[model samples]
Target chain A: MTHEAKTVSEQTRERLLDAAREAFSQHGFQGATVREICRRAEANVAAVNYHFGNKDGLLAEALNFAPLKAMQLANAKADGNPEVRLRLFIRDFMLMLLDETNGSLPCRIMARELADPTPALDKIVREAIAPLHDFLGKLLREIAGGKTGEAELRRCMHSILGQCLYYRHSHPVLQRLHPKLRYDHKKIETIAEHIADFSLAGIGYISGKTCA
Target chain B: MTHEAKTVSEQTRERLLDAAREAFSQHGFQGATVREICRRAEANVAAVNYHFGNKDGLLAEALNFAPLKAMQLANAKADGNPEVRLRLFIRDFMLMLLDETNGSLPCRIMARELADPTPALDKIVREAIAPLHDFLGKLLREIAGGKTGEAELRRCMHSILGQCLYYRHSHPVLQRLHPKLRYDHKKIETIAEHIADFSLAGIGYISGKTCA
Candidate 1:
């Protein structure tokens, strides 16, 4: 309850989250076990129960940190022309997605959950992800030029996010097909720019045309 | 066998595929059961085993239909301009995603499968998916002036495909957030245009700039 206790508890929770990010991303939720998470965290198995209560709860809590923090950063860096700001946001978002501190597990797990969502999905959307959705939709609306519809906008963001995340999520298989595509700074930036430009151009045309 | 017998067998197999598509798409591979598929198809459980060998086999066969057939239709009408043909391909691909004959279940199943790809992935990729991927990647290459790196071209194709498919795959969540968004024909076409333009511009810019 005291400030010191809160800080200590928070650090412990952060460690658990760090471990969850790695485990869930690698093995997936159903495949990830609590014992393994505890081992990675170097904390008591009861610590997870004590901190977040269950595996699903921990997973949900863990996913919240990176995207939420990134969305905050993306919104904060709103600058230049509408197009420029949107580009920066896309860049930041892709960078956030690759936050190895959190890893690509959140994306993999969140995506899997979307296909066959569980109850924890409500918490993820409500707490961690909805703000990013709102932020993007609002940005799209401002730049939309009155030509965009809600569905088109959603699809637009979905497209951008999907393209951004696909390389990392599919890295294993992509490398299987070709050995050269490494996940590093230059490649990530190239892909990020492509997605933003492609997405924004689509938005520009859609907004100009009045149907998207 | 006689031609008539082969035709009848094909129809029976089609009926089984319809059932598997719905079941697998709705419940995912592990989540879906053979009994439920038979119940839906109005065929005996024995028919499923007889037709596809098992649940996994049924899923693979089911995924092979619809999209490939529709993609063939798109490719058949391919034109001198790969970009223009690509625009059409994106349109048909969206329609395939909306293949109401199977409902949204196939979308869900495929999304989940991609999230946690199974042993079934290679077959799904080889029989049903690789051609489309290869086709799209080649279009990107032509658009990129055919000078892009192999890994870069593959990544580019992956990005475009991810964006297009992610719209349908993530529709449920996006719809809830925007309540205003709908996946109707007009809207789908609009988003497709946006994706095509966005991707085209990005590919052009990166290929030109990076290659130069």
Candidate 2:
């Protein structure tokens, strides 16, 4: 096709993805309909089939969309000390997980996946989560000074990530438990610092190192 | 009514609750149907109304069922050393969260609620989660020797609970990441020990105590 045609097709694809994410987030995969997604995207009914091959295809694309983008942003700077890197990683991760400006579509969709997993979950874990896990594990190993056992290191990684994820996954419960607690930008920073410090101490205690 | 009739009615209610928990766990609140739930329970169509009032009421009851039951088990013995209490708490909590024999209905339903919260969540948090939080918070305070600040104490609680809950909330991801890892009785014990030890060190480090 011509350049203008290609650009229009690309725009339509992006719009469909945006609409798909919102629908999937709200209604889940089995509950969301292609016609409604098309209506929300303002695209022709055939657009989804033509661009994504089918609704499942669209769902896969939408599920893969946000984390890859966030990954790019998270992996952008890795030059700091492991401690600083851990803090930055926690801050960026909390920000990504708690971001509401984009309607939290990523987190909402992910929460849905956790609740009712589809075949797409394996791909997500392999492509998005596994890399992030590796990144965190490496940083953790650096901080632990390479003496921690594989199992302990893995558990420590889970501890750090579990702390970060609780804010997003149990957000409704958190708000109710602490009525004043909000994930405003400032609160996110505070949470990031707290997780980082607690994790560093936990690691230090495990790895026989004093947290400097 | 008569005593025998009351006994039959109570049996029907128990059946409905079991069916409701299974349906809501699989399909979420909005996706689960009263008809399907009745069918599963092998009860009269109007039994849900007579038992729990409506679908929303059923959802509320089903959502509140497991955690409260688990709380009783967790709180059954609280007279031990604070450290032993923490280990037992983590063990029981993990067991409740990872119990596959019950089809993991409690954790699955809880995950669904987290993904798509209804009005029932506030009740769950207040009636079930808040008391548990207070219980853990008080235990954490004892471990910290009453020296940790309130905010720090709360974060520490989140950190500890987050570690335990992550194994449930992120089970699919965890499975994919470590396909060989399984939550048998022994594995749960190991995880409990790790989290208890890690958390004790964290609390100790933060509260200026040496983990004995």
Candidate 3:
């Protein structure tokens, strides 16, 4: 295709992905309708089929697009102490979840997918999540004195990530239990600091080092 | 009014609740049909309306019933050292999630509700989850030497509970990450011990107590 044709096709693909992400996050995969997605994207009825082949294909692309973009942003600036790096990773993660313009669409979609997985999960794990997992694993190993077993490392990693992700995926339950807990930046910073301190302490304790 | 009539009514209600809980857990509130529930319960169509007023009422009751029963089971034999008690709490919570016969219905339903809450959430939190939260908070406080401030206590509690809950709500993701991590009794015990040790160390660290 010509350059102008390629640009138009790329723009339409982006629009479709944006619309599909919003729809899937709000209504979940099975509940989201292709017609509504097309309407929101202002694309032709056949656009999803032509560009992405189907709704599932569109969903896979959408889910991958949002988190990969956020992960790229979070992985930027890789020069700091492990603690500072951990803090920045968490702060960026929280910002991605609580972004006003997007409003946690990536997180919401991920949680939904985790709850009831689809064909997209395999690609998500390989492309979007596995690298992040490896990155966090390395940071955790360094924080734990660099000598823990793989199983031990995984458990520790889960402890840290579980804390961060719990706040996002379980927001409704947390709010129900604690009505005053806010989800704004200030609260997220506090949460990040607490998680970092708690995790560092846990790591220190596990690694036989003094935390404070 | 009549003694036999009361027994019969109770039996029917029990049957309806069991059937509705299974249906709702599998298909969610909107996707589950009253007809399917009635068919499973072996009850007439009017029986649900008669016993529970409507589908929503039946669902609320069903949701309440499952968790309350599990909570009661978990709360049994609560006399032990705080650490022992915490281990039991985590173990029982895992058991409830991995219950083979019921297959995590309570968890699935609860997750669905948290993802897209309805009016039932208010009652579920107040009636089912609040007591458990209070129970866990007390256990954590005792483990932390009973001197941490409320906010600190809450963050600690979230850390522990988040760890336990992550294994449940994110099982698919975890399984995808580590195909060898089983969810049987032995594996659950190891997880419980790890969480208890990790949490006690974290609490001690937070409270300025030397954990090791």
Q: Tell me, per candidate, how large a share of the native contacts it keeps.
A: 0.42, 0.56, 0.47
Best by DockQ: 2
Residue-level lDDT of model 1, residues A27-112, one tens digit each, is 66766789898899888889999998777778768774465566567566657476777777776666655545434566656755
lDDT of each: 0.69, 0.78, 0.74
Candidate 3 on A1-212: residue-level lDDT in tens? 66445687799999998899898877778778899999999999999999999988888778654564556455655665777787777777766665555455766687666655678887767766677788888877766765666777788888887787777666777787878966777877777878777887777666663223
List clashing residue pairs in candidate 1: A25-A105, A147-A210, A149-A212, A151-B181, A198-B198, B25-B105
Better of 1 and 3 by lDDT: 3
**lDDT measured at residue A69 in model 3 versus the true structure, 0 to 100:** 57
Candidate 1 vs candidate 2: the DockQ winner is 2
* Candidate 2: residue B42 lDDT (0-100): 93
Q: Write the per-residue lDDT of candidate 2 for residues A19-82, one digit (tens) a residue.
A: 9988987677877899999999999999999998888788788875455456545564666678
Q: Considering lDDT, where higher is better, how would the candidates rank from best to worst?
A: 2, 3, 1
The positional error of residue B56 in candidate 3, measured at the CA in angstroms, is 2.1
- What 10-residue stretch in candidate 3 chain A is worst by lDDT? A203-212
Q: What is the C-alpha lDDT profile of model 1 across B115-181, one tens digit per residue? A: 5677677665565556667767776777787667786677678777787767655666666666786
Give the per-residue lDDT digits (tens) of candidate 3, residues B172-198: 777798888677777777777777778
Interface RMS deviation of candidate 1: 2.7
